[model samples]
Target: MSSSPSSTPWSTPCGTPPLAGGPGGADALRPLVATVLDALHDGAAARGGPLPPGGPEAVTAHVRDALADVLPDTGTGAEEALHALVTALAYGAADPAHPHCAAHLHTPPLALAVAADLAASALNPSLDSWDQAPAASALEQLVTRALATEIHPTGPAPDALVTTGGTESNHLALLLAREHHGPTLQTVCGANAHHSIRRAAWLLGLPEPVTVPAPDGTIDLTALAAVLTDLRGPLLVTATAGTTDTGSIDPLSEIADLCDTHGSAFHVDAAYGGPLLFSATRRHLLTGLDRAHTVTLDLHKLGWQPVAAGLLAVPDTTMLDALAHTAPYLNPDDDTRAGLPDLLGRSPRTSRRPDILKVAVTFRALGRTGLGHLVDRVCDTAQQLADLVDKNPHLDLYERPTLTTVLFRPTDATDEAVAATRRDLLTHGHAVLGRAHADGHLWFKATLLNPHTTPTDLDTLIALVEGSTTR
Candidate 1:
């Protein structure tokens, strides 16, 4: 059970006056901060696992009741009111760290990364201009340079930027691709390429993307080559490193060779599979990542970090110059001429959060090898779940687990039956497994992130799924 009304730790006084010349210092926020922390502790320690039953309606009601009077009043001692809101927000939402919560790319954040996030939030440095965030500007450069080394260690380090996620990263890459070529251009991509790529083209006002055949969740090189040959104008070939529906990596080397033959700029969307570069045995899967003109990587997906941690890298820094502008106030010619560093030319956002801080903290805490182990753990769990699917007479493995995603559904059940199973799981506080449709069929997608989940725990999940069939 969640924290009770009588057990609420909101006795701390509220509406404290601000300190002289200091604004709301630690003393002013002490009461509310302490109460909020206590609320978090209680919420995490709730009796049943992280998620509560009843789904969206339950959580929405929790919030509505907690703040129903917010529209009318602001004079009340806010301790109880704020406490109720935060507490509801905590226990009402689904917890990704739970052993049975295998739904999406969401991962349980590391303790150190969370701490770093809190610190960065408090600082609230904008990474756009150097004066706005002096240390952040320099530090972002250093970290991005270091990250560039990881992708292409042997070659010249690509320039990097902290982006919103794979969407923005892919958008920026395609934007550059469009800029490199004139209005007359074609974009060659797999049918399974992320929707963001097509949206990026639309945003760029380019013609519709030319998609290649990908029946088996990966690009067919022959079809890709045929598309490349048939294309006449400047070509932008984008390949998938890890497809969304099925985690299948395209033959990067073969694709890279075709791009070379076509003289097209190659971009790789490695948002899901980029972390596999850390795995010693699996790194071979992305052998030609270095050859791509640009790459998109999302840390929140597999980097064990919070959301909004994404990166875009270009092997040559000049590629990003397309997005550049001479803003005299932000990056003046005088400042550029001087020794001062300017980070304003990198990304689209003007005042962006320095999420790279938390990413850096995570990297420092868990070295490359440690990060690789985390990836391996999740991938191994995926393999285990796939094995479970293979052994079960009812289930069918969509394909092998290239990363940490498993797609399967009951062989004896209908599409409605499969979807109903997922809905029942959430309604009864079982597990929040993902449900998706691909190849005109429904599938249950288990995206593993928590290493603490045991095989027995998965067996219970399987049993629950089996039980849902009768419903």
Candidate 2:
């Protein structure tokens, strides 16, 4: 009967590759890293623009051809596989590094951070237990606590959790609130808040949030007050530091006052705008941020780290008590008495990567001043883009940007034409721009996250949009 599965003969795993850890790991990785680097350069050279020519079908076909034989009977060897796939991906990538690729909040990762990520990958530390990630666990604690203190200096004992990104951070915020306030917790947020906030509430089986008007993209204080006054029982008021469609921050102090008046919990989704804390010039934009019970921050958006660098900070370590859990295999009672750090409670996730290493490296490499410079650079570039749009008689600026996002559209163009212009630009691989509806019109949304963007780049973007409208 199938020769008894356990007794079935099996040949040694084919083409066993060298590991990326231990003494010989570096020696083994050196050549493969070189191969990857060369492939990246060659592929990016082939792309020659912000994105590969042709749309989805062309990209899919190219990748399919490059990655032929996804599960080959015999191996093609590690170097060959790495080179082929990496090159193909690089060629097909929507490169955030290209100045014209200013579509979303996606940041071009910092080289140092990426390099640090490589080390983290090599180490392959699983953070669910201290034994698997001894030094890494300590590093995470140090870095997260330091960041928490930055956000809540007045807090009794501020602490933060390393998250995958804003989505996960927002999810954890809602989860923690649910644990504290019970299932009856009602979430109140602005119409302009990130969609994740509502999703988080739904995932937790909580009541559908009550939405307040964001008339000018920031919450209407009077409207929020009215809602808070009417809503009974436990309430959580979620505010937006920077809105997605328009980068407008709610009046934080005013909202906090309402929350206080109603005795409701407060949370701020600053996923897009939290990094302004680094900039001395712009820190005032986030005034009253510390008043929130929980705050979400995403470094991948503006801090220039690779994807998956997000944080959920609380004023005190005790505030996270609701997440405490025990797993005998991971963190046993004896281990705790012996002072081994129990990591399972730090997040809802169990199998977590050492994402903190890259963030720590970035913080060490670039102190407050260096990071502030990057923030200011992008903001300045956005202003320049707005100026170009405002001056172009063919274009109309939605508003003067408060942060790095600039929304503008062709003057007097139909909403349909505005949408088509964005599509035409995407199809032709000319530029990557986003679209947002504001002031009852669809506008071309240029979210400038690349600090390297220049006035010349902004001028070209305006010209391209103007030309597309005519076409």
Candidate 3:
């Protein structure tokens, strides 16, 4: 490798220029960040109305036409160039802050967290070692302890590290489990468990994951017991804290019992519903979470932080030793475990971004009470939407709301009609909803995470649905 200071930049790969002041200098970034933030605000407001109709080609053509000058042939001044690029990209996307954006488990990031993201990016700190980021590593350690205390209070104080998102978090859990259980590992989970578990199993050089059927969107204990009886090798069983489609929670206490009986590693995938730990009324749903050997939570989902803030936490710090690897230059022995975790050891990523800054900022800004209130509000909103659908003459409610997702469909509408109504809703931009096939019927889905949404907004959404179907 070249030994020159300018030859190899920090964090990023060699030859790629750094973002700080490569050509445009430091003063250029202030205006750029401001302009990008403003454009995002405006774009979100416009997207709250209705969507226009088009296929990929039309969208591509329109975007290409509008952004012809925005993308550079040669780089313009950094501030102007950066602003134009983000603004063009923000034009017609779903605004998670919108009242009608109840399609997925995604939430609007807390304001302080979002601002912290900008600052972190501007500073470009790396978490691989303390030499690169001293205070940043300390903040990550504090936040990890806070999350561990919240999730596994009575158990040994857990160790955690941030990853890209829920998918990566799930992957890390399984990876650690495999290291602890050996390559002959057999994993078990409900059919409704997040798809990432299966993918993670494949990535870890294991056979396909054995799935237990969940007819009511929960793991069948008898079926799991049968599987345990026949299996002989090391095992990892995943119990879902909250599922993706219907927001259903698996029976964690029962699953923990089975894991104990069989001497298997128990992991809980709580990426979508883990924040319920903050809600007094909903905490019972995750009663046995402390018994889990490993747990995954996504700050971006219910934690109200930006994307790429998922966490994988283990009940005992020793379990994380499975992923430990040493590099002489990177983590010297005396320096390695000096009251700070080398996030690279606990996570699949190396040279990781400073994702902890946002989480730390969010925790400090929102505190526990504010976060609990937001969770309560979103759950209440989901229930309200479910009640609305149940009361409507033309609509049928499919699954009850557990955390923040409600699945329903029009009672009188056919599959084709439901599909058309969904397409029309998207094309006309009246509201954005999700659709999924369940029990031989297509169900219209809504995930309520925006607390500002009201009953009136839901009423108007139903009215629009009714109008679209009739038309």
lDDT per residue, candidate 1, 1-471, as tens digits?
A: 333323333332333333312343444445556777887766656526647787788767877886777656444345666677777777776788887888877888887887788667766788778887888787788898788777866655467878989999998888888788886668888988999999998988988999999888889999998888888989989998887777789999999999999899899999999989888878888999999988999998888788889999877666778887767888898988897776677787888988999999998888988988988888898899899989999888788888888899989678888888898898777888897677788999888889788899889888888888776
lDDT by residue for model 3 over 66-151, one digit each (tens)?
Answer: 56765455544434444455554565666677677677887887788988887788777788777877878888888887888788
Local accuracy of candidate 2 as per-residue lDDT tens digits, 1-471: 222212222212363556789987786677778878989998899998888988999999999999998898876666678789999999999999999998898899999999999999999999999999999999999999999999999999999999999999999999999899999999999999999999999999999999999878999999999999998999999998888887889999999999999999999999999999999999999999999999999999989999889999999999999999999999999999999999999999999999999989998899999999999999999999988888888889999999899999887899999899888888788889999988888988999999888888888888888888899
- TM-score, model 2 to reference: 0.97
Q: Would you list the rank order by TM-score, best first?
A: 2, 1, 3
Q: Which candidate ranks first by lDDT, i.e. highest?
A: 2
Pick the TM-score winner.
2
Is 1 or 3 the stronger prediction by TM-score?
Answer: 1
Candidate 1 TM-score, C-alpha based: 0.92
Stretches off by above 4 angstroms in model 3 are 1-28, 45-55, 69-80, 337-343
lDDT of 3: 0.79
Report per-prediction Cα RMSD to one decimal.
Answer: 4.0, 5.4, 5.7
lDDT of each: 0.81, 0.90, 0.79
User: Sort by lDDT, best first: what order?
Assistant: 2, 1, 3
